[model samples]
Target chain A: MATGNSEVVNNAKALSIEVDKMSKLRVIHYINQFYAGIGGEEKADIKPEIREGFVGPGMALNTAFKDEAEIVATVICGDSYFNENIDEVKAEIIEMIKPYNADIFVAGPAFNAGRYGVACGAMCKEVQEVLDMPAVTAMYEENPGADMYKKFVYTVATGNSAATMRKAVPALSQLVLKLAKNEVIGTPEEDGYLARGIRKNIFEEKIGAERAVEMLVKKLKGEAFVTEYPMPAFDKVVPGKAIKDLSKARIALVTSGGVVPKGNPDRIASSSAQNYGRYDISTVHDLTSETYETAHGGYDPVYCNADSDRVLPVDILREKEKAGEIGELYKYFYTTTGNGTSVKNSLAFAREFTKELIADGVDAVILTST
Target chain B: MVKGIEESGIPVVHICTVVPISLTVGANRIVPAIAIPHPLGDPNLSKAEEYKVRKRIVDKALHALTVEVTEQTVFEN
Candidate 1:
């Protein structure tokens, strides 16, 4: 009877081991034509295709994954073709990957290659959305595609050249396993991924006041200590060519001071505005107290409400037009409240209106903020 | 917002009370204002005097737009 019990226990252990081996996480690898060893730039327009198993870098990935995960299939597409026919190619790739039942999708450690980086980012993003599975790729920080897609996918940071492939594969494999296993992900700094600009709340042992005081002490002592919230880096723009002849320059007025027509016709938010208003002042000469008022909520708003021109300076700009100091006013002035507004939304507002300004032959803009 | 307009190839002069904040945000051309609450004119001044202050700032901004600059520059009021 003791011998029978021992035999049953041994059989149970053997069955569990077999199950573990059979249930290894399945990964589908994606690569561009170049990485597939099909050809370089010449074959950059090849249509999407699939191979049964690991290709090129996938070999390194598979070795890194070892017993934890396996590359079930490899999908390859040309850079130019994928980008040009993104919608069609994405659907096709999704269909191809569907049969593999992949737990995670991994794309190229594209490095600084522009088209290849874009292709990798696009593929990873699509796979995550369509398959409802975790997807990851790697690219250099400065790759334009990284900026565009990092928020949507987990992009591991890679060096500028493929020479870093040795370092990249292991990191990529580790991230893939973490995702497949449904483990908690570390910060971008810890996991070597690009900062996704996501704000996640976590409990800390120390209270907020203690953390603040500790940070202050460290700052006062000139010790290097990381802040809980870091300021975003602002983009520096090189100045455009100056308007040489002001008398021939068509000027326009733009404001973030929240100076809009009275009664707030567009109903732009007093704070954190999502939209900007474009009002025509072609016939109007000045911004009178009866006609306009302040919509901004950040400031006292008393003075601005008393005289709207103090914020927008339309009265002065109109004077300049009449005095021939400027060629003409663009007729339409763009205004929005900047109070508590996100930089992203502010950029979007300017982007859409600038096109109209260019189309209207505006040469210079005088932008006001409060 | 100033950066976006400047990046679109239009010369822009930012009028703000906080010159340092404007400078840090990379405004290529800047003209300082009197104060934050009333950037263009000082409420302490009489109506006509306030107009003069507003005109001076605007005049400086006009001059700034015409002056060629390779980097960020703040025009005097």
Candidate 2:
């Protein structure tokens, strides 16, 4: 549920293409629970169904790919398909869609639903393997599906909920059209999808060997060299509606930008941390002692703290609370090391923390990132 | 960081040294500062100037709490 960078290159550069040189290929759409027009939670086991034409985003896909490919059929299933019945469901869906001459397959702009994400990842993997066809899916960067299948398919960061379906569909559809037309996708950002371990042989603007030398020189000089392919914006994130009340509400301060204690007392790894623990400071307000520290390696240490105050600015937030600028600060602030944290863990932590916040009667939050 | 917090049904005010990145990344509310590393104040500055910088950004963060916009926004002093 974290906010995402909005600096995204949404539209691809209109590269030259011979429209007549491309052939119309068939494409298939896959959908889960909600989009299948099936009920949720109450209808978790409604079984699978295959239908011709668009469901949910299929109409949008049809519009985006109208000139490039035809979506022959739309396949719908409960997310439980791959999760509960992996082998049977995969085999059945493959057999079901086998009749269509699908050039590519598209599953969710999964947003951030955990079960739906896993289902999309599994189904895309199977379709790629069994049918030997290219497939595309989109998941939020924080979705576990991204880590599991990003290397296998073009996974875009979708908004965590289906509300982003319209925004998510266009990018995925455009990618499929380009794939069908054999159009060169310049980079992940330019192309609007995740890189699927497929590297294209492109001539460097400067000669190849010279490009390498230039990069080496920049590295040696410690210049802030931007990578050739900038990380694409996970702009598919839909900012949830803002909380309506703040001044009268209980607010908590939280951060994932790895603001921890000075000496790394928790022994949390500098990157790829698996465990997150919170210290209880009910007796004292600020995390000022030497016992607390940060484990994030992405930034310089001087500002984070010799004392933990710099990273976790609970002291300032508490001060504001005492002055009535905000409602009472929650007793304990939540924290996690954000460096290279997997999307799945972040989502899980958010869900868990939300529960705690609710139970504690906290109404709003002011999160800081360093 | 702000997205997750906001999704938890809370308002988050992001304070950053590099303001553009945060705003574009869809920060609903933002407070801009002098530089990326030391967002509040440059350690090289005198105490008075540093305090001024910190206070300005902090004030912007607070201001962000009361306004609304559909797109990402950063507050400048």
DockQ each: 0.28, 0.10
Query: What's the CA error at residue A188 for candidate 1, in Å?
Result: 1.8
Q: After superposition, how far is residue A156 of candidate 2 from its true place, in Å?
A: 3.1
Top lDDT model: 1
Query: Candidate 2 regions off by >4 Å?
Result: A1-24, A197-201, A205-224, A228-370, B1-77
- Residue-level lDDT of model 2, residues A314-337, one tens digit each, is 655666677787677787777776
Q: Write the per-residue lDDT of candidate 1 for residues A29-132, one digit (tens) a residue.
A: 99998899998645766899999889999999999998999998999998757765778999999999898888999999988665577778888889888889
> Cα RMSD (Å) per model?
20.2, 22.3
The window of 10 residues in a row where model 2 chain A has the poorest summed lDDT is A7-16
Clash count per candidate:
0, 18
Clashing pairs in 1: none
**Candidate 1 chain A weakest ten by summed lDDT:** A140-149
**What's the lDDT for candidate 2?**
0.66
Quality class of the docking in candidate 2, CAPRI style: incorrect
For candidate 1, what's the RMSD?
20.2
- Model 1 per-residue lDDT at A76: 93
